[model samples]
Target chain A: MAERVVEARHLSKVYQMGDVEVHALRGLSLDINRGEAMAIMGPSGSGKSTLMNILGCLDRPSAGSYHLDGESVANLDDDQLADIRNRKVGFVFQTFNLLRRTSALENVELPLRYAGVGAGRRQRAIAALEAVGLGERLDHRPNELSGGQQQRVAIARALVNEPAIIMADEPTGNLDSKAGADIMKLLLKLNRQDGKTLIIVTHDSDVAEQTDRIVLIRDGQVEADRKLGRSKKIASKGK
Target chain B: MDFIASLQAAIESITANKLRSALTVLGIVIGVGAVIAMLAIGRGAQDSIAGSIEGIGTNLLFVMRGDSQNQVRNPQPLTMDDAAALSDVFQAPSVINVAPLLQGSATVSARGESTTTTLNGITSEHEAVRGWSVSEGEFINSSHLLGRSAVVLLGTAVADDLFGRHDGLVGETVRINGQPFRVIGILAERGTGGFSNENDTVMVPLTTAQARLLQRSTPRSVDVILVQAVDADAVPQASEQVANILRTRHRTALGADDFTIINQQDFLDTAASITGVLTIFLGGIAAISLLVGGIGIMNIMLVSVIERTREIGLRKALGARKRDILFQFLAESSLLSLIGGILGITLGWLISVGVGAIAAAANADIVPKIGIDSVLLATLFSMAVGLFFGLYPANQAANLQPVEALRYE
Candidate 1:
């Protein structure tokens, strides 16, 4: 009954290392509805990162049927996938990926620039930075900001596009626990208040405990799919 | 992304490593500057030489008394009779004027000042043949020759030396080798050009100089004859005709003549080939530097791609297509070359102007000029080098995978 934001019937990815064929993913199929906060957890070499890359449209599966918002994406060309990624999905990497020496406002406006959204772009960027509590650091470069502030700016960049879903791969991996907790809280609040679909890929159980659903991957297949009832009720409406 | 924004990003990156970018473009600057300065010098030298040749008289041809290799004094040298024969209307229509010259050096004095200078005894027709015009008074005429008048014309430098800028210079009497001669005319002050200075000699009538100044007998012989052709294109024909007449007059077989001829067109052709070869030599050396500059650009661009791999990854993640990355690096490298080109042109212009100033101060004829061609060449060369050298590195950057680039440490 819910609107499906991500639907993967069968997914596989193979990497060639010299003469060896390494199967990073094998027949992995998963789905996430709109406005849901979920975590994909796996150990190293379990293909969770590959799955996240495939879901984010940054990498295509070797064999799969992927339907994102009812559009067949598995057979799309590179440029077509790039267009889809530009307009539909936002990615948050573990390193924050803020451009060095670039102002926080400019970094946030980068996606909008690629999307050809002009006229009042700076104002929108400013508004997004303000939403992330980075209004005072608009002019500051990445080196000028603290780890927490940088991650906040990265979040503003991802949210600026208002994509169908946000994919975060170990977003808090490089932060101190305090900064990590703050980032997790921000992600949780975005899901609850703004009704945004959030997918966080990680190896930490404690971090995964904050989400509403958990899909554990092992050897590139779904090992467990569990639903959680947290202290705050999960929001079901899309903003 | 829009073009302006891409350029802005490129500029930001270039400014981020200002020292490296400057060092990278130094080769281009030097190369372009060398090209422009060399072209100016070559162009200036050719122009100066051409001007002097024209000043010597484009339609003039010379008939020396002897061959080019030897200056022999024959029992029968070329006389006014030969000049008359060459100027006869039926014999050669292209011959405009023929002037016979008998040259000698003597100590000339007026009042207390004296200077040793060459004196030329020539006919009034010398004015038309040699392209020398009097600025004051009148040149020696036929009456001066028939009467053997004790009158002379002072060259510009000669007048300044003997009269010391004195007024009434035309009326002043200058004694030459002990005989006082009245100054009837003063030659104009033409600069020392590619040819000899025309303003540094004194002139007298041919018959008077032969009879009185040098005291020679009748049927006197002259040293050289000046013949003016009707036009530039007729110089070869006029020269051949004069040679043929001289051979006949001397009663010699062909190629065994007593006199030799030098035409203005032959001198011009020799001068042009010399300057042309020199220009290509200098330009070829400068173009080598440009090739070196192109290689330098390629080397720096490769290093830039490696240094900014993470940044490339970041842009790709930020939704930049392959073209976006390609354009960014290409624009950055080309901006480097464009800036270098502008700087080089400015430096070249300054050096050329400095050369001209030095030449002028040294009383030299060379005046270097920077024209539009060198400007256009420098600009186009730099841009072409930038684009051509920027190709491989930009492609390398653009072809980088977003995931691998993001993963690059």
Candidate 2:
């Protein structure tokens, strides 16, 4: 029922190596609605990662029409793409690509720095870290923290800028089962309570079952789109 | 990031690689130190020469008879009457004092000890012209001339050689050219004057030497006519007047002139110009070492860029601008050279002080004067070397693409 936040038409990504041309994404079109928690499920080489990159504005589609919040991203330059990534989209990686030598607070403050936020905006960063249950570990660096804490710091960094959408690539792939479940719970809480659009790419069936809807991607095309009945149980527990 | 942060990062990185940084900086240190030390020694030598020339008095002039060709052909000496005629006839306000010198070499014996020395016949005013002072007893004066006393003033070297640790040679008789002459004074040591030893000569009144020692008619044949100008500012005028008067007395026109007037001021100026040129030549050669040091910096920076490729890529991925990366490397290189320059300056100063001490111990007239300009120049040159050599690698780092850099392992 919510308005569509992302619209893609005839999107294709190609790579050229020597004389060989490989198409990573093939003529894909999709729409992502606002306030929706969706999981894009696919096996290896299914082009899910490519789709996620294109959606996050990290890489451009070779030939396609991508409208992110009603703005065409297909014709944008690298800087413009980076600007869109900085201003609109937030990314969380499976490995938690946080700066190794810097503290958690500084990691969350990175996007704010790109946004030209002054030092006075530190309170916003503290709030974001506290939102991810990482307020107590703000001064700890990535190497000093546990796996779950590091992922929480990454999530805090992703949500610090209050972006339009959070695109995660196997956000819990590197964590243990318990940590993975905890991260899933946090993602679900962010989706339902904060009303943020969340698109996660994962191969785990249990993780996919937690989202509001699941879109099965096979060979760079959507195979099935289903809304979950289990969301009702999670929604009851959210209150 | 802010400048302070960037500088702090650069310093931290440099400090982390302590041995590598120290070795790199050592090249610059030696280069700068050599440049400073060489220039200081050269400058000190120049100053010493100029100081010695000044001690001899710039207002003095020497008039010698005949040109080089005639001196080779006839070896005819000048007459004392010629000196008097010029002194009386010139009548210029710039003319202050004139003395004629007749020099000859002979063996002088005293108390069974003998030394070969140069004997010089001169007037009382010769002391003023030659800037000589008596170390002990009286100099030959009007009384000695009026009495035609056979008296001589022994130079320090002559007295030391002939007397052999004896004190107060005054009133003692020393035989000059086989004739006895009482020692009236001992002249202070005047050091060497390039061509010969100045302290090996003995002085006596011209009339007394001619009458008693030389046994020659006219008794006026002289080697040089010494003249002192009334003031330093009047030397040029006095020199020209003496030349003109001598030429008139000799009845010679320009180009056919028989006498040569040597101006001490002109000689000092010429010596200064020559030493300046020598200093630049030596300094230029020494600057080559600095250039080599700069090349060493370039070599090291290139290697550093290659070694830190991953770090550069990571920083670029973190949103560092091209200028940021460039400034980081440039700052590192500059710090290397700056530290080296400081150490080099200190080393050069210590070396100069050590050299000065050695010279002082040996009682040599050489004094090394280290200048402030050399230190400042070395510092600036080292910085310039850093900037110049660091440019290529910095450019390579700055131009790296963020995507390619992030993908770099």
TM-scores, all models, native as reference = 0.88, 0.79
What is the DockQ for all candidates, taken in turn? 0.58, 0.19
Fraction of the reference Cα-Cα interface contacts (below 8 Å) that each candidate reproduces: 0.49, 0.00
Off by over 4 Å in 2: A1-118, A121-239, B65-76, B89-91, B102-122, B142-150, B154-169, B172-181, B188-202, B206-219, B362-372
Model 1 error, position B63 (Å): 3.5
Q: Model 2's DockQ?
A: 0.19
Q: How high is the CA lDDT of each candidate model?
A: 0.86, 0.79
lDDT by residue for model 2 over B1-409, one digit each (tens)?
Answer: 4565557656876776789888888888888888887788777777777777777765888889787456434423568777776577436557888888777777888888898888888788877877888988887787887787888899888888887643578899998878898888888878663436778888888877677666554455777888888888888888888877776677675456677788876777888898889878877877887788778888888887776776665454334556777888898888888998999888777777777778667655666777888888999999999998889978887776544554455
Model 1 Cα lDDT, one tens digit per residue, B1-85: 8999889988998899999889888989988888899999999999999888878776888888677667444624888899889
Docking class of 2: incorrect
Best by lDDT: 1
Each candidate's interface RMSD, rounded to one decimal?
1.2, 3.9
Per-residue lDDT of model 1, residues A1-239, tens digit only? 77899999879999999999999999999999888899999998999888988898878899989988778888876567767787778788789988897899999999999888999899989998998888999999999999989999999999888888898989999999999999999998888888789999998889998898999999999999998976234443331
What is residue B232's positional error in candidate 2, in angstroms?
2.7
